[model samples]
Target: MTTWTAPAIDRRHEPYRADERTMLEGWLNYHRDTLLLKCAGLTGEQLRTASASPSTLTLLGLVRHMTVVERSWFRQRFAGADLPELYDFDADPDAEFNTVDTADAEADFAAFRAEITAVDAATAGRDLDEVCTVKRRDGTANEISLRWIYLHMIEEYARHNGHADLIREAIDGVTGE
Candidate 1:
């Protein structure tokens, strides 16, 4: 059987000057593409290769994680979509990361792309300042804005992409900014 490889990604350059919304979305997209670029052309086994001993982080795991993050923030928390967890975190807190050994890399990639589409649709036409109130486990309600979600997503992707850079480098010695 042939090994499945992730497709190539053409990341756009974020503009130096733009409106607030444009700047945030542009940087988010750039970082999103950066993560995929780090995994491009690698087979499923290669994508599942752990960074180092004791850390199960992998390119494929990051992809799964961000997919969950995208759905959790944009759909469940902000957009108020009633949805079940993508991966069974109850059964295993690190399900996404730990299940890579038998995961279908191609399907996971497709799901990630699909979640991004759904998140975009969910947030479309919503004002950046539009707020959503989430009930915490502690019985307190916290209000969050769409703008804050965007900023947080950018930070999440940026941190994971750094891990991806190292994992990709360890896999094949390919490195870049």
Candidate 2:
């Protein structure tokens, strides 16, 4: 059986001098691309291989986890779309990060890209200060702004991309931005 290999990512440079919205989105996209770059040219097995001992984190798992983050924050919370978790998250909270053993890495990456596209479309023309109230799993409502969402997602991607960097390095000694 042939394994899926990650394709190359063309990462764009984030602008240093840009408007607030542009800056936030650019950084978010930059980090997103960075994650893919870390996975680029790697086979499915390599992508799914764990990092150091005692940590099950994998590049494929990071991609899957980010997919859930994009979908949940933008579509489900911000746009109020009635969407279910893509990875049976409720049944297994870490399902997205732990179920890479048999996961189709190519399909997971595709779904991640699709979620980003959908969220971008769903948020187009939406103002940064536009606020939405989301009910937490505990049934408490909290208000969030598009601005905050962008920043939060940027943080999320940056954190996971760090993990990706280490995982990729462990996989084949490839490292750096």
Candidate 3:
């Protein structure tokens, strides 16, 4: 029985000698891949293992959550694509994180990859200064820029990648940036 493992994150983010968009996209992609790299070499159940009691976080959950995030920011918000969220928020808030024990990790991984491609397509040929109206969590809307989205996504990945580090360590005793 072969256990599924996350692919290696071999590419490094661009540090210098790149334009603004190139640098931003490069960093974001690095973080995005970092999340998957953290899950490499783990079975679906292992990816579903929570770090500790009372926490529903798992690698699969993170994949689902980030998929939604990418869809929201790039497709829905930026591109003005009208679409419902991937997960049901009314019936089950935090469903992405809470309901991953039986979730298909490979499928979610594929979906995440697809969403990334879609996001890239949505944002391509757009200006960083181009602003879009985003509904905030507090029910207030504000005009935000593509640059902000890129930065927010980078930070989001960084934050989740931190969680991923701990989860991976707990799962198989593998650790590193």
Error of 2 at 71 (Å): 0.2
TM-score of 1: 0.96
The deviation in Å at residue 170 for candidate 3 is 0.6
Q: Point out the worst 10-residue segment of candidate 3 by lDDT.
A: 1-10
**Candidate 1 lDDT, tens digit per residue, 1-177?**
238999999988787999998898889889889999999999999999999989999999999999999999999999999998978899999999999988999999999999988988998889999999978889999999999999999999999999999999999999998
| Model 2 segments more than 4 A misplaced | 136-139
Question: Could you say which candidate leads in lDDT?
Answer: 1
Steric overlap count per candidate: 0, 0, 3
lDDT preference between candidates 1 and 3, better one: 1
Candidate 1 Cα errors over 4 Å, as ranges? 136-139
TM-score of decoy 2: 0.95
Pairs that collide, model 2: none
Q: Report each candidate's C-alpha RMSD, comma-separated, in the order given.
A: 1.3, 1.3, 1.7
TM-score of each: 0.96, 0.95, 0.94
Query: Candidate 1: lDDT over CA atoms?
Result: 0.92
| Tens-digit per-residue lDDT, 7-28, candidate 3 | 6556566567789999999999
